[model samples]
Target: MHHQEIMSESIETTLALVDAEIVCFKFVVCGTVFH
Candidate 1:
């Protein structure tokens, strides 16, 4: 249904944002440790 599609899209967006945030945080930590 249309509602299911919308829900999946929203979930996918949220997960992508979360993954990006985690990667950024990890890079920051590594930079600080190495620098």
Candidate 2:
């Protein structure tokens, strides 16, 4: 049970990082296109 909790937390963290990166990338692309 403890191992499962750790695994889930790791997955969530990884997903969050990926999501942040994607949002940053989109913002950069939009900024470039607009300018």
Candidate 3:
């Protein structure tokens, strides 16, 4: 049970990181296009 919990937490952290990166990428793309 503890291992499963740890796995889930790690997954959530990774997903959050990915989401942040995607948002940052989109923002940069939009900025370049608009400018």
**Which lDDT values do the candidates have, in the order given?**
1.00, 1.00, 1.00
TM-score of each: 0.88, 0.89, 0.94
RMSD of each: 0.6, 0.6, 0.4
Clashes of each: 0, 0, 0
Distance (Å) between predicted and true CA of 25, model 3?
A: 0.3
Q: Give lDDT: candidate 1, residue 5.
A: 100
**Position 27, candidate 2: lDDT:** 100
Summing lDDT over every window of 10 consecutive residues in candidate 3, give the lowest-scoring window. Answer: 1-10
Estimate the overall C-alpha local distance difference test score of candidate 1. 1.00
Q: Which lDDT tens digits does candidate 2 get at residues 1-35? A: 99999999999999999999999999999999999
Candidate 1 residue-wise lDDT at 28: 100
